[model samples]
Target chain A: MTDSINATGADGGLGGFFQNLTDSIISQIPFWQDVLLPALWDGLWVTMQLVVMTAPLGFLLGLLIAVSRVYGSAPVKWLAQLYVIFFRGCPLLVLLFILYFGLPSVGIVLGSFMSALVGFILCNSAYNSEYLRGALQSIKRGQLLAARSLGMTKMQGVMYVVVPQALRRALPGVSNEFIYLIKYSSLAYVVAVIELTGAAKIIASKYFMYFEAFAAVGIFYLVIVTIATIGIHRLEMKYAIPGVSGAVGKVSKGH
Target chain B: MFESISAVTNSAGYLLEGVGVTLLLVGLSLLIGFVCGIILTLGQVYGPRFARWFVGIYVWFFRGLPNIVLLFLFYFALFPFMGLDLPAFGVAVVVLGLRSAAYQSQIFRGAIQSLSEGQMLAARSLGMTKWQAIRSIILPQSLRLSLPGWANEYPVLLTDSSVAYVIGVAELLTRTSQVISRTGEPMILYLTCAIVFILLNYGGMMIIQYVEKKVRIPGFGNNEAECL
Candidate 1:
C-alpha cells in the first residue's frame, strides 16, 4: 500500500475493473500533483483575492443601502429599493459583461479584474442589503427610542445600539450570501479573469483531460465551501444567545 | 438624450427569440427537477439508510460545484466519454436539471418533515399502508406547503439558465451580447436584457403567488415560514 499500484490491462471481471482503476489513478497522481495543483493553486489565489476584495466593500455598501431603506426619507427608500431590484435582477454574468464589454462603448471601460470586482460587489450588495434590511426591520423600534431617551443622538443610537443586534440577526443570511459569493465568483472568468475555473478550463483544453481538471476544480470548491460552512456555523454558535429571536426560540418550533 | 435614444437600435427580434430558448431551458430543467425532486425527497424521508445515503451524495455533489464548471464538465467530459454526444443545449439542460433537483429536493424534504408524525400514525391506524398513507395523507399538504419555496426556484433557475451562455446555448444573455457586438449598444442593450430578466423574475413570481392564493386552505398554513 505504501508504493503506487500499477495493475496494468486486466480485463473482464470486477477484480480487473479495480485493477484498471488502480493503474489509472497511479498514473494520474504525478500529473495531478505536478501540473494540476500548481495551476489551480494560482487560480485559487486569484479567486480568494476576488472574494476578499469584494466582501467588505460589498458588506459596507449593503449596510448603507439597508440603513437607507430602513431610516431614510421616502425618496431615499425608493432609490435603495430600485437599486436592489435592478442589481439583483440582472444575473452576474450579464452584469460582468455589461461592465467589461458593454461599458467601453459608453467610454467607461473597466479592465477584466476591475469589471469583475465591480460587478460582484453590485450583485453581492443587493442581496446582502436585502438580508440586512430584513434583520434591521426585525428589531423593535422601542430599543431605538430607549437609546434616544438615554441621551444618544438618532445616528448614535443606530450606530451603537441597533446595528449590533441587526448584524447578529443578519449573520445567518449574510454568511449564506458569502457562501454563494464563493460559488458565483467563478463567473469572473467570463469576463477574462483567470480564476480557479478559468485555470482549470485552460489546462483541461490543453490536455483534453476535462474530467480530471474539472473534477479537481470541484474538489477545490467543495473544500472551500465546507470550510466556510464550518466557520460560519462556529460563528453562529459563538454569537448564539440563550433566548434570541433568530437564534434560539425558532429552533424549538417543531411540530 | 433624444439622439442617444435614436441611436439605441437593437437586433430586430433576435434577442426576443432568445427569450424562448431561455424559457425552454428553464422550463424543461424545472420539469425534470420537479419529478426527480419528488423522488429524492421520498428517499430522504422514507427510504432505508442506503437510499438516504445515495440521495445525500447526489445533492452534495450537485450543490457543491458551480454552474459553469458543471456545464463544462458534462459538455466536455461526461457526455463525450459515455459516447452520448448531446448537443451543448442538451448538456446545459441536463446539468441545470440535476442541479435544480438537488435544491428542490431540500425544499420538498423540509415541507414533508414539517408535517408531524401524527398524520402518519393516524393514517396507519385507519388501515392505510405506508405508501397509501404517503400518497393520500402526506403529499397533498406537503406539496402545498412547499409551493412558496418551490416557486422561489423559478427565479433561481432563470438566473442560472443565463450561465448556459458560456456553452453557447443561445439564451437571452447570449443573444443580448450578440446584439451588443453588432450594434455596439452595450448600455442600452444590456439594460433592456436586465429589464426583461427582471420582468420575467417578477412575472413568474406573480403567477406563483396567484397559485398560492388560490390553493389556500384556511387555518392550515404557516405564514411566510421560510424553509431555506
Candidate 2:
C-alpha cells in the first residue's frame, strides 16, 4: 500500500501532466523532421500538378462554355446554362466521389489521380464559365459594335478585342477561383489520391502527433494561399486598364 | 444503364435512409453554425482589437484546412484528449458547424459592411446607443442583404455534409456507394445521387430567388432598363 501510494504520488500530479505535454511536443519534432517535410514536398508537388493541368483545361472549357452561351443557338445556350448550374450547385466532393467510385462500375474507370483531376477540372470550368460569362456580359454592347465598325469580322472582333478585355476584367474573380481550387484540391484525399491532406493524415496516424502534423499542413496551405494572393494582385495591377482600375484596385487592396 | 436502375430501385429504401441522415446533419450543423457565425461576426465588427484578432485566427484555421482534415483532427485528435464521449453524429455536427462558422462570418461581415455609413450616423444623431443603433437599423438591412449569399451557402453546406460519410455518418453518397458495392450497379446509384443533389440545390436556389424578388430594392435595376 505504501509503495502504491508513492507510485501514485509520482504519476498523478501536475508534474505528470507537464511531462506528458513535454513528451507530446518532443515526439512531434521527429515527425516534422522525417515524415512531415517530405510529405509536404510531395503534397505540394501534387497540388501544383493538379493546378497546372486543370487551370488551362478548365479555362479552355470555361471559354468554350462562355462562347456557347453567348454566341451559340438557343438550345446550345440552354445546355451551357444547365451545365454551369448543376456543377456549381453541387459540392465538388460529391462530384469527386461520383467520378472516382461511381463511374468505375460503369466500365468507365478513370485512374484515381485522373479521376480527381478530371472531376476538379470539370467543376472548376463550370464555375469559371459563370464568371467569364458575367464578365463578358458586363462589357458594353458598344465595344462589340465598335469592333465590328472597325471592319473586323465577328470572330476577329471577339478574339482581338472582346476576349482580351473580358479576361482582364475577370482576373480578380479568376484569382479567387484559383485560391478556391488550391484549397479544394485537398478534397482529392477522399478519392484516395494521397495529396497533401492525405499525406498529413497518414503521418498523423503513424506518429500519433495529429496536432503538429496537421498544423504543419495548415501552415503550408497558408503560405501558398498568401503567395497566390500576392501574385494575383501583381497580375491584376499589370493588366488593369486606367479608368476602370479604381474598383478592382479597392477590392485587391483591402485583401 | 437499365440494369443499373433495377439495382438502384432495389436499394431505394437504404438510400432514402441515408438521405434522412444527410438532412439531419445539415439541419443540426446549420443551426449551430449560424449561431457561431453571429457571435464571430459580432466580435469582429464590435469587439476589442484582441478579440477581433482571436476571432480572425479561428476563421483562418477552420477555413484554411480542408473539411476532411478538420473532421479527422477533431474526431481523432481532440476527442481523445477531452475524454468526453460523443457519437459520430455529434462529432460531424461539431466539426461541420465549426467550419461553417468561419465561412458564415465572412459572409455576414461583408453584408454588414455594405450598408451605408450614413444610416448608422443618422441613428446615432437621434440619441440611440451604439448597440441600439445596430440592433434597430444595421442588422435588419444587413440580414436582408445577406440572404442571397446565405442561400448560396446552404447548398455548399449540403454538399460538404458528405464528408460525414468518411466518419461513417452513412449520408446519401456513402449509402449509394454501399448499395453499388453490394449490387454492382454503380451507374444508376451514382447518377441518382447526383440528380438528387442537383434537385436539392435548385430547390434551395428557388427559395432564395423568391426571397430576393420579395426584398429587392425597387429602384436598383430601373437605371439599367432606362439606359438600355
Q: What residue runs in model 2 are displaced by over 4 Å at the alpha carbon?
A: A1-22, A245-255, B1-3, B215-228
Interface RMSD of 1: 6.6
Clashing pairs in 2: none
Give model 2's DockQ, 2 decimals: 0.42
Query: Among these predicted structures, which one has the highest TM-score?
Result: 1
Q: Which ten residues in a row have the lowest lDDT in candidate 1 chain B?
A: B3-12
Best by lDDT: 1
**Chain A of candidate 1: what's the TM-score?**
0.88
Q: Write the per-residue lDDT of candidate 2 for residues B1-228, one digit (tens) a residue.
A: 677677878888988888888888887888887889988998999899998999999987876666776777677666654454677789999988888888778878888898889989999999999999988988877767776556556677887888777677788988887887788766666777888887876776677677677877766321111000
